[model samples]
Target: MGGNATVAVEATTNRPSSASIVQTLGGGSGIDTSALVQSLVDAQFESRNAALAKREETLTAQISAAATHKSNITGFSTALSTLSRSGNLATQPTSSNSGIVNVTRLSGAVLTDVNARVEVRQLAAAQTASTAPVTDKAAPVGQGTLTLTFGTASVADGAMSAFMPGAGASVDIIIDASNSSLQGIAAAINARNAGVTASILTDSAGSRLVIKGGSGEARAFTLEATETPGEEGLSALNIGIGASGTTIGSAAADAIVAIDGVAIKRDSNTIADLVPGVKLDLVSAQIGVPVNIGKTLPTNALLQAVSDFVDTYNEVFAALNKDLDPVTGSLKQDIAAKALKRQLQQLTLAPLASGAGGAPTTLSQIGVRTNRDGSITLDSTALSRALVNSPDAVEKMFAAPSGAATTGNGLAAALGAIAAEAANTTRGLGASEISYTKAKSDIATDKTDALAKADALRTRMTRQFASMDAKVAAYKSTQTFIENQVKAWNSQD
Candidate 1:
């Protein structure tokens, strides 16, 4: 009979059996068992690993945005500090005759409307002592312990009078076989930073050792040589008046300067204590001629400072606003960035410095106007008027230090605070990076765990499926033998 249903009978029961189904389906289980196990293991871990990867990528993007936010804050701070350090915001001290006396302001001293007259009587000089001519610079000068003592020497009637030793430690220079020659001794003395310098100068007569001292009166020194046994010519370098060619080329003397005809003596040519807020460096002596010191017109300086500050302020706000934009992907609706943006906008109206009554304290008072779009503009005429009326106050305000970050309103201090917070390692700029890195690390660890589990599943399932397939293959062979036996028995019957 032609029929779709075809089966084999069992030997004992003589009924259609599972062996017939197996034979019809082909050999064994008729499935790629190895491929099936691999697909199952891949399915278990693929979705989890993909989720971890996506999270890591998002963290990376957030860290990049944090860097951008930090850049803006620090840029604002550095720009303000540069402006203050450049001295473009202050009224510097000016000298009428800069050739004679140059003026420099050392500190944030308010020298507004202050003037002074100074006259340089004589400039300070350094003392130089030359020894007698030597036939050979490399020849032995004898061994000794040369002691140098500093003192102030006096002269009366073109002759030596009295000597007063300075209250300083005496320096002893040792001369042995290694440093016994005039050149060697000079090298030995040069090694000491004891306010004394020595060198062998080859002159018309011969080579002579010359010793020079520091430029102050207290630095004048006299040499005493204590000779060792059999050492000759050691005392030749000693000072009495002293020796044949030993002479003081220039005596170290204190500088004499006059402030408004009042005499002042200092050990250096650069004088600062005579006048407040300014240091006067004497170039040459002018017997009675006076140099006038005064303040310069800082209108142009204020103009440029105002311009730079406005532009920088605008830039900082612009970048910060972008980061805090609600719809933007980067730092969207970030609380910290939003707060910083508001604080930066407030800096335009914040007081810059402390001064006398009626001074222009804030940037707005001095003509900086904020626009609707967060940018700012300067009014040159208003700034000039402030300069004309309150010149001292104007100088006082601009001359103030860049505000600190926390304590004061100086540009450096106030702006520095914001910058510090932005890049702060624990709680600010670096905090987000730390979080993202930690998350990425966790993702890596989870991926490792997931892979380990997947590997174990693949191994266990592959072994189990192989065992099941082998048992099923044996059972099918047994069923086929029984089915053939039943047919042969029926045919014999």
Candidate 2:
């Protein structure tokens, strides 16, 4: 119906249409004209579309390769930076008698060798005060304020101090009938945290309340008691030197040690300041024994760091060298690829800054040499001797002070710079890969446009075919009617 309307509209307007001329129908003309038109369209468009698809595939492969190359190079640069920093170096610590006193190195703490005689006279002790044995552990001792004061007190007088000078703020523990038992008083005293710990001690004799201070000279204390008129039993908890109600532990004393014949008194057994970069822990009283302490370069740590740097350097070069392979990589013919490989190779072989006092300048001089495959190999024996003889020179070679790029900044620094450049996202290979991806995207857009035009042409051809079919059907109907009329006229004659 719509096709008839289109033809009727054109006839009413007296305008000629593209399909105005009548053509024979498929059965009448003995031809499959619609199928022929579709075949022609396919022949016109398929080859160009296949070529565009191939171009997109090639571009995508190259972009992926570039991405992988950038990742490997960046990893190499990060590892190189670890080798350039001086803080990464390890310090070796040794003690002549580890059983006597154990030592450990602290982070960021520089240790140096020192010859010293350590004499441990005594270990620091805490002040402990104990109440006299009581028959009932749960019975209330008193109900009042138990005042604790800290100051220097003589152990002989039933009061004791820690190894350090007395230092404590006065604290008060309140005792009441509700919580005045040995266990209750201990809990109350502990809850105050007034520079002391409290516990109920049970022995064969009876139960007793004990309060102990820290193991330092600054922890001396005196305990006094005041009781309410009805709670005068609390006074039994009072503690002092020679006090009848309480017994004091051994006198608190400072740890005493002599290093190199210089006497030193510390508030605790863990002594760290007697010698520079050396800590002496007084385990037992050995008044005249000398313990030797030594510090050396941490050879194992140095070896591992150097090994990692070398291995990572080889990995970066391997990624670049693969481009030279004929069949595997897309970069085989790329000039940038060759230049990158050459840059890293030259940097690895370049000599580092000379040592402070005429040491080896090149990595090869210290037992790390280039292999036939362009990777480096290390000789541990040679490196160890070099380290022993000229340790300062070896360090300067890798971690020289900041100066001119060609003169002072070490080989590690130079290699790091090249790696950074190759992997730089803003202007390096990563950026180049991004451009490649964009180009690939443009090719995709072009293919899409070409395919869309082909589809549009198909739509136009279908509509034209439909109009021509309508005209052909109408002409066939007209010819059939005229032939029947001619036959009727002959019959009538």
Candidate 3:
């Protein structure tokens, strides 16, 4: 029977539709919509946070770089200061001529009776023949044992030999068999700190060994066994009698010289140590029963100074360029860096090309040159030649007095000026530069503050998103209840 369907009971009016609930809660899709929104927001925040973190890292790197740059600048400044204040530069000897001059040349008279003199003598000794005996005819000839006696003390073992005082003259003998190897024997004798040399010599006459003491000392020789006899007995070998000791003598002159009225002693014959900037060499010494000294001017020192300056300048310039060049991705990327590079380049090349007064300025004049890399290279050789040819002219170029109309500056003075400018707080952006220091501080502060702000914002955003998630969850439950009631009513109908 087709009975009329019973009318279904409607759910309570208090129940709201899913759409209505969602609309009241600001129109979000039903599936954990708050969580999704929060996730997106959190992702955006993280992205920003990551960007800020990178920026802070970059800032930190920059600060470190700035500190390093400042240190380098300070080091350069200190080096420059030292160079400027280093009184007069030391002189170098000329290569072509003898590197000394006679004291009499300056006095216009023969300076005789020099106090320092070295004594030399020659030693003579008789030659002796020695031989080593082998047991088997087939056995190769080998070195035999040698016994040396000094006063009562005697040494027996392998032989350590060397020539006597005079070369191609007499031979000295040393007994060096102390339970040590040949090398050890040599080491022990050398360690004695006695000025002597030991060596072994072999010839068609067989092997001959010798020892020689230093000049002014006598060396003695004695031999116990000449050759390796099959018998171990010392008396069986019948080594020959040794010669009496003799003395070898040679002398090196004292290195003291008088310069500008100051008497100074040095290790080398060159007079650079006596005069702050003068290097003199001994040209000729005529033996007049009392030697007569000859004098020569120092010309190499000035040339070398200019050359050294140029080389040093170029090295510094290359370093500066590397630091400031943008293509290399160097840490330095500031106006000051650029300016320093420019200044170095200018300074390095200026001496080579610029002229003072009416004279033409050639690096050959001052002792520097422009290298292939557009940098300055010191032509020490050319400069030296110029100085030898015209020392006074070279000196004038570097240290000449100024005229009434124009004030002249020397190389030392110019370097000092550059150093002063570098040290000036307002000039280059070096360690003393206010702007550089301020930038360092300001960037550091900005990075710190930005990081702190980002951290705080992230924490607050986290809490807000959590609260929104709870509210969205409650709204979802209410919508589920309403939809379930509508389903039940339709089923009953």
Candidate 4:
């Protein structure tokens, strides 16, 4: 190992090997290279942020569209409800073919002491001379008289009474018990009240009396015999009349009420339809009908529509917020996502300021409110009240007015203008129109554009890595060449 004999010790340079160069440069082992890698990481985050921003924008547009659709449904529903409330909807008119007549007693009290008598007579002759005559002609001259006897005290004691055989309870006095017949009974009952319906029922048995009580309670019947002694004909007819002394009250019918100069006929007999959007229930029908008008909306349909609108709006907003919120850490990183979220919040809250002077400046006016975390809450009760109080105001706030320049910042109009250059369709855009076609076409086009941008950003990041890898390889090659030169120099020595 002496140095005199030309020791063959190989000299090697301290230059790094290829593997070391790659580890130091490509693997980001050094501070400078680590910083560059961090830059690429930051770029990746930016790409993600850009994607989320685009999604947020699209979702914002979608929420606007959904709000517009909801507004349209609400508008149509409100219009129909107005018609119903105003009683403008079709109804069957009152029938006029029949006549109604009221019947009331002139005496106002039941005739308890009246006498009723009926006689049966056959139109043909008797079968035999000895046999009793069933017909009036069979009875010999003046032998056809049939009479009912009422005692002398019958009328005074209120014991004598009479009634039409089939009549409900109406009866007339048979003044002459010896002479009054069934025909006289029928005539008296028929002439009592116009409300009663009277007719005769003639059959094989004989002619009988049939009477119907008028609209009022049944009339009382009593009979009193005329004291004519030795009247065999009156004694022969043993028709006994009794007293009926019961009374009942009659029910009064309903009357019609006119609404807004139009006869909106209802059996309830109420004046509720005079005021629009109110419902009244009939309370009683005595002298006149009384009613209680209900202030609440009759149906939950309108409230349900508002609820649906809120649900749909919240769904789209939630999706947007998930992508844009910084704390959630979605596919989109922070910068662009945060910007977009801030922009959306600003846009939504701008009109809510008191100075905005629009139809619905506050979220509560249109059924929305802010939660503790800046999220939105649906105020259904407030919304319902607002709609019930001023439905047209809400409708005009969301939709274009018929005759005037659109003063309100409606959802459809706002979204249409904002998404004009983007590939989203706004609500109320017709299918045949060029703007609408373009808007529809843009949905796919916008998505594609977003994807393309994301891909381009990814490609740029990869190219940058590739360039960094090439630089590391070149640095390793240089180190290898220098080491070889040092080896050659040492070998020559």
Instruction: Supply candidate 3's per-residue lDDT for 53.
Output: 63
- Residues 127-228 of candidate 4 have per-residue lDDT tens digits of 100111223322311122222221111122322232333333333334244324545534543555433333445566544434333221122222223334
How does each model score on lDDT?
A: 0.74, 0.69, 0.42, 0.37
- Tens-digit lDDT track of model 3 for 350-450: 44223435343444344465656647766566676666665544554444222322113444444444554455566544453465446657656766765
Model 2 TM-score, 2 decimals: 0.66
TM-score of each candidate?
0.79, 0.66, 0.43, 0.25
Each model's Cα RMSD: 6.2, 7.2, 13.6, 23.9
After superposition, candidate 2 runs with Cα above 4 Å error: 1-89, 110-112, 130-143, 156-168, 173-194, 199-210, 232-236, 244-246, 320-355, 359-365, 369-374, 379-382, 392-493
**TM-score of candidate 4 on Cα atoms, chains taken together:** 0.25
Clashes of each: 12, 13, 15, 11
Please report the candidate that would top TM-score against the real structure.
1
Off by over 4 Å in 4: 1-301, 327-361, 400-409, 415-493
Q: After aligning candidate 2 to the native by TM-score, how far in Å is the CA of 168 from where it should be? A: 5.4
